[model samples]
Target: MTSFLTISLDFELHWGRFDKTRLRDYLEYYQETLQVVPAILEMFEHYGVHATWATVGSLMADNEEEWRAYMPTVLPQYKYERYSAYRWFDAQPQIWEEALFAPHLVRQLIDCPGQELGSHTFAHFYTCENGGSAKAFRADLKAAKTIAKSKFGQELKSLVFPRNQINEAALAISKEEGFDTVRTNPQDWYWKHTVDENLIKRLFRTGDTLVSLGQKTSYQAPQRNGEELLGLPASRLLRPFRKGSLFNQKRISRIKEEMEAAAKSGEVYHLWWHPHNFGHYPKENLRCLEDILQNFSVLKDTYGMESRSMGEF
Candidate 1:
């Protein structure tokens, strides 16, 4: 079998970060993201790369009214009130008109060749949050599919749970809703499903990007649960470009080495990141991406490694 390279992006704007971020602080980053998407599409097209955009369903709306209309009846009820996406919207609904809505961008994504639209859940729903029931998760997914079909005239086939919160019960609902596959966390211990946040795990995750501190994450094949959805476990996160970072070259070198190993060994190497990760330093970020893709081209020549979207893989 030929080695495969897959890229999936979590394309949520303000929706994914409402719990931890204040929009005013990152307004410039969001603004740059609008430019980043088109550039990313151009680069992908030029490199013959196919990617899945796991979009937040709310980003499918043209305005706040459309977004509100598609919201699920029962929202996530996390013990930490500030973690609620709905409550944050309730506090300042008007701000969504500008910050949260991104239907135009989603339209651009659909038009871009080789780009597949997938679900990141409606409203960036948190599946593992304590107070949110399985019923609420299903309701949220139903809203996601409904809006996606109504807006794009296409059924969503892949999902990436918000905050990497994978709920087994929710996977059944995802399959019932018609997803072909779902992106899961890497099989490393640090990336496993957990409600409790740990500083050591967080630090290790960050450090892994710059150096191979843990396991080699490449996979040879996907797994299937009883739900019948293919489990496309992630391999690595393409960390964003940081200014004055001494490890920039080391990070890129680590990614290229991993890709080469996967290609030589005939395994799948999946890389993912958010569009906003490129938002802050568009030029630098694009250059880093180009470097990775350039290495992929070399791998293709030597080993016939192929590029695939999540659904395609």
Candidate 2:
């Protein structure tokens, strides 16, 4: 059996960080995502890397009107309304920034060979937030499917929950909604899926990026026990490469070590990150990605480790 390496991206533009991020502050970073996407695709093709772009469905629309028209009927009523993308979008009907809409970028991903376009959710739905309901999740899934089919002719088969908030109630709905695979967080206790952020978990997770302070960051193959949906748990998050940071080498080395261990043991290694992670340092991030992929090429020849999209499992 070959060791499998999977890459999934949380490809939400403003929708991913709207609650806390002000577009005015990070406009340049957001704009960089559009510029870096083509370069990222170019690198993937060159390195024979296969990835899943688990995107925000609103990104498929050309404008805010089309996006609003596809809003889920049962919207989430989070205690903090700011968490609701629909509420945020409703407040600002006219989108002044192009950073929020990226139909062209989504189209490029769809047209790219060996790339899978999956759903992050219709509006970056928070499945684990307070007052969230199964009805809302199901409705969100339906809206995502509807827009994706209409825009890109894609039947989305993979899902990466917003904020990695895996809602157990929504698993069956995901299968019924035609999703075959879903990315779960790592098995580590600190990596447990949750809407509420924990300070201890954050400290451990942040420290682990530079050193072996937590889980080994490797997992077995995705489990599909007589079910329509397969559990494609992530092994590690590819921390954004920060230029001029002394910790950059250590972080990259840790990731490489985990990848090597997975390759040698024939385990599964799933690496994920957001496209905006590369927004600030596009060139450096691309170089870091190329280095990782180049190492993967070596692992491929030596151990038959294969690069796969999330749906492949």
Candidate 3:
């Protein structure tokens, strides 16, 4: 198989973090995300990078009324009430427009060349959380497809589970709902589970970005499962740029070295992050992205590495 690089962004604004953070505290951070997304798209266009924006279905709404209009009939019933985004929306019905919804940004993704509109589930559904079921997951996927087709005239072919919480039943339901591809976590000990409370695994994930802590991050393209869903395993996260951090260059170098290895071995290297990751230090984060893309250009020219959206696989 040919060497490939895939980029997927978890494009939820506040919905992704609402369970763990106060909206008031992160307002400015999310507001900045509104600006960062377009800039990221511009860089992708310049670099001829193909990406999948795995968006929260709610963010596609133009306003609160529209978001409500598209809400799934059956909501995820996480045993931990806070994990349910629908319940959170119920408590705070009033919209924080810039922080909550972004149909305009969704439109930009559609307009951008080589960008694919993919699902991050309706309401940022957490599949692995307690009380979540296949029934709720199917409802979420339906709502996601409904809004994307109704608002943007696009059918979502790929999915990225919120928090990389991949569940087998959820994958089966995704295929039933017409999704052809989904991003899965790397097949490493640290990535096998998505428990947020596991500090050791989390530390290993963070350390792996700078120093190798696991197996080779890049891998051969995954074959389709019996369900016919393509499993696009993530290679690494493009961690947010830290201002004046001694390890910033090392982080970028780690990714470059992985990309080089993938290029030489004809494997797939998948990198992902949230657009809001660039919200805080836009200039620096974007520069880091450009640096990586520059390396991708070299790999493309020298080794025939190809850029692909997750859906394309």
RMSD of each: 1.6, 1.4, 1.3
User: Tens digit of lDDT per residue, candidate 1, span 1-313?
Assistant: 6899999999999999998888777888888888898999988998899999999998888887888899898777778778778888788634835567788888888888888999999988887887778888888888998998998896899899888888778887888878888998887888987556799899989989876777887979665656598989899988888899898888889989999999989999999999999988899999999999999999999999999999885
Against the unseen true structure, what C-alpha lDDT does each candidate score?
0.87, 0.87, 0.91
Judge candidate 3 against the unseen true structure and give its global Cα lDDT, from 0 to 1. 0.91
As a whole number from 0 to 100, the lDDT of residue 75 in candidate 1 is: 79
State the lDDT of candidate 3 residue by residue for 72-183, as single tens digits. Answer: 8888778899998878877984657789899999999899999999999989888888888888888889999999999899999999999888877888899889999999
TM-score of 3: 0.97
* Candidate 1: segments with Cα more than 4 A from true spot: 93-96, 223-227
Better of 1 and 3 by TM-score: 3
Query: Could you tell me the lDDT of residue 71 within candidate 3?
Result: 90
Compose the digit string of candidate 2's lDDT tens values, residues 1-313.
6798899999998989989877667888888889999999998898889999999998888987888788888888999899988778768745555878899999998888889999999888888888778888899999999999987899999999998988668788898888899998776778886666789989988888877776667777856878668988887888987767899878888888889999999888999999999998888898888889999998999999999999888
Reference-based TM-score of each model: 0.96, 0.96, 0.97
Better of 1 and 3 by lDDT: 3
